[model samples]
Target chain A: MKKLPEWHRIRIIDNPVIRQALVIAGIIYLFWSMSSLDIDWVRVGKGFPRAANILAHMFPPDFSRWQLLLRGTIESVQMALAASFFGMILAIPVGICGATNLAPKPIYLAARAVIILSRTFHEIIIAIFFVKIFGFGPVAGVLTLTVASTSFISKMLAEDIENMPSGQLEAVRATGAGFFQFLNYCISPQALPRYLGVSIYRLDANIRHSTVVGIVGAGGIGQVLAASFSRYDYDFSMAILLTIMSLVFLGEFFSNWVRSQLR
Target chain B: MSIILKITDLTKTYPTGTKALEGVSFTVDKPQVVAIIGPSGAGKSTLIRCINRLVEASSGEVLLGNTDILSLNSRQLRRARRQMGMIFQEYNLVERLTVMENLLSGRLGYVGFWTSYRRKFSKKDFADAFELLERVGLSGYQNTRADALSGGERQRVGISRALMQQPDLLLVDEPTASLDPKTSRQIMRLIVELAHERGMPALVNIHDVGLAQAFCDRIIGLTAGKIVFDGSTRQITEQVLTDIYGEEDWSSTIRKIEEENEVGAE
Candidate 1:
């Protein structure tokens, strides 16, 4: 047989020794973290039966306080609706200002800062803050989800606007269309569908977050669930949980239908 | 023939330090179609875009029917732009909009923001749009989304959209660059026909010498961001092609135009 030429595959990290050292460090860190956790096997063994006992008590959900449950659920839905409506309205200008291709440097920076600040904190943390200011009601939930949804919708919308094809916009500009006219005629037609789809998705997400905000005393189904837990009313809490799950399921279905129609 | 467009020493140096055009000047006094033929990166696109101030000239004047387009403020520029229609290589239709909406968008300059937003265009604008659509051979495609059309059909829509503006000057940048040879010829024919029919001056940047010679009344050749040849179509020879596009087998390029002329004459 003829002599074969040697071949070597290129690697992402070209330095073999450094690559090996990094891999070794990763493995060691993984093991160290695992060992550092105080895993009490005896406590874990007891937790299963305790959990099973809770599950047993959770069954046969009580419908005696159905009116209270319905009111709380309705409050959550209203919070979600208000949040989605306000968030969508606020997101338009913020999203347009944030798009690097559209806005000047200062405006782009300001809009981006708003987006980053809104995104930095978790929705529950925001809900806690709003609850502090708004004094325990669905107002806090609405405000909290509004901030969350605005950030999300604005960020996604800015990205979509930045990525749009410039040809259509250029053609519109060539027609001597004013800035706002160009926006309505060309940019709107291109960005509207995606914007609406993202808004609907944010609305669905807000529905789920509405229940969580109530745990912080922001007033929703979660507040009632927390009360039921405190009172040892596990059956009622179970019913509330089921209601939340169904609300989320219905929201997902509606969002999916709307998105499909948009497409 | 009166002075329609008089470009004086137009120049464009991109931020990246590329000199796309240098002291390029031209005059189009008649309602005739002029073709700009050049190699890639020879400032053909930059030159045409400069006439409408689309690509801002570094320091120069573009006189469109006695108005110094380069000196206009943004508001004045928007008003000035209404006189010049532009066609693009990619058609540039808002793909999500229906064909009628795309066509009516040309009237965006004449209408108010809220009026255009509500899509309540004037009846005359709608009538003109329908007529332009019929002229472009896409009469019944008003309800179709722009994305659904073929390339040629989209170009037709693009042409009509520009025409809907009632522009006095037509600026075409590689209008048929994306089309096949036959479709390109058809589009070129349509553009030239429309320009003559409306008595509008047109400046077309084309790559195909044969098509340019066949349709355009005059030819302007560019090389290295400078105008090398400017005369009637019959004035272009193999030597001129060599001067514009560098040395190659000029015989075939020149022969193709001759064959086209023969076919055209017959």
Candidate 2:
């Protein structure tokens, strides 16, 4: 065989010398950082006693205030339900508008910008902002989760719409269906199963987020957990945490049931 | 002959600067079934789509009946498109929808969004859809989802959806590309028979010369974005086939297919 050409011989990963140097540098940095930061093992040992005390107080989780805990949990679920409902409704239009294949360039760009902006901030931060605007209550929690729901659901939905096969869409348009009319038939049916799946996922995530937002004085079970913790009522805090976990599990079971029923 | 579609100096250049069609001109007259045959990427699809203004032409005039399709506004384009029924190569049905819903989608142009959303199809339209399913040999599959159907079966549904439009002209793009040869012939025969019965003109884009010759009244051959031949199927000589597909070994290709068929039979 003839000698190989320069390009054929030159692979990016063929530079073993540079690769070895990078690995050595990474190892050196890891050891150096560990040495520079002095960690006191005895001081860390003290944290265990406080943890043990809190654990000791958490036994048999007080349910005397069961009615109050149940009310807060119901509020959180209601917030998630309201948010998921409106978010999915609004997301359908927004997602379709943002899909690069479905909408004009400017409209797609604008919709994308809105989705990105909503996603940039965490739900807690959004809740704080809504609390300032709408005043602290379940209203703020609902608004925060609704905005969060739109960001995730709309972005994923837009991606789904974008990734869809163009042949069916073209066939629909060929028969004289307008853009909105096309959505009612082709996009609606094609995206329904996946859309329902994503919506259920968002609903589950929103419920979890709603619990956390309550710590910031947005209404939910998290507020109850935070208040109980601050008052040294670890048993009540344990009860709230268990309730939140149970809620999450229930949502998961429901979402799976809905997915199974789609076909 | 009365001309239903007239193309004048039609051209299409994609944004990437690929010239899919040159200044090509052809007219589809009356209820004649015409076939567009060419090698892959030789502008057969572009030529077929340009008539319906599906692929926007860079420069041209496409007259559907008397109205210049390219000159129509968005509203008028929708009206024009309603008169043209399209069949896809992949049998492009909305996969999750029931067959009846897919069939009713053909009337989406005539009905508004809300009417179609509620499935308020007129009694006659619903009746016609049922009749069409039977005509396409898929009567019992009305409630079945499109994704559940086989390739040939889906194409039959594709045919039903197009016919339900009660289109004046059929725009077929490779109706049998994915089907087995026997099914391919059956589909072509069904399409031709349906068009003949309705007196609807049809422009079919096909890759197989043999299939085109078998079903179509007139054949238009394209090479490198230009029409090299346009005539009756009887006039398509072996030399013309070679010219269209660029040195294609037609005899050998046919022999290989025959050999495959013999193996399949065995």
Model 1 lDDT per residue over A1-263, tens place: 99999998999999999999999999999989878997788999999999898789889988789999999999999999999999999999999999987899999999999999999999999989988898998988899999998999999989998998988878999888998888788778889999999999988998898998899899989899888999989888899999999999999999999999997
Question: Scoring model 1 with DockQ, what do you get?
Answer: 0.81
The TM-score values for the models, in the order shown, are 0.94, 0.91
Worst 10 residues of 2 chain A by lDDT: A5-14
Model 1, residue B231: C-alpha shift (Å): 0.5
Where does candidate 1 clash, by residue pair? Answer: none
lDDT tens per residue, model 2, B1-266: 87888888889999999999998988888798999999999998888888788799999888888888998999999998989999999999999899999999899889887888899999999999999998999988989999999999999989988888889899999999999999999999999999999999999999887788767889999998898999987677668888888776677545554564577689
**In order of the candidates, what TM-score does chain B achieve?**
0.97, 0.93
Which residue pairs clash within candidate 2?
Answer: none
Q: In model 2, which regions exceed 4 Å deviation?
A: A1-42, B249-266
**What would the TM-score be for candidate 1 when compared with the true structure?**
0.94
Write model 2 residue lDDT over A1-263, tens digit each, in one string.
99986765665667889978888999999989887888776888999999999999999799889999999999999999999998999898889989998999999999999999998999889989988988878999999999989888899899999999999989999989988889888898888888999999888888888899999888988888889999999998888889999999998888888878885
Off by over 4 Å in 1: A1-46, B259-266
Scoring model 2 with DockQ, what do you get? 0.70
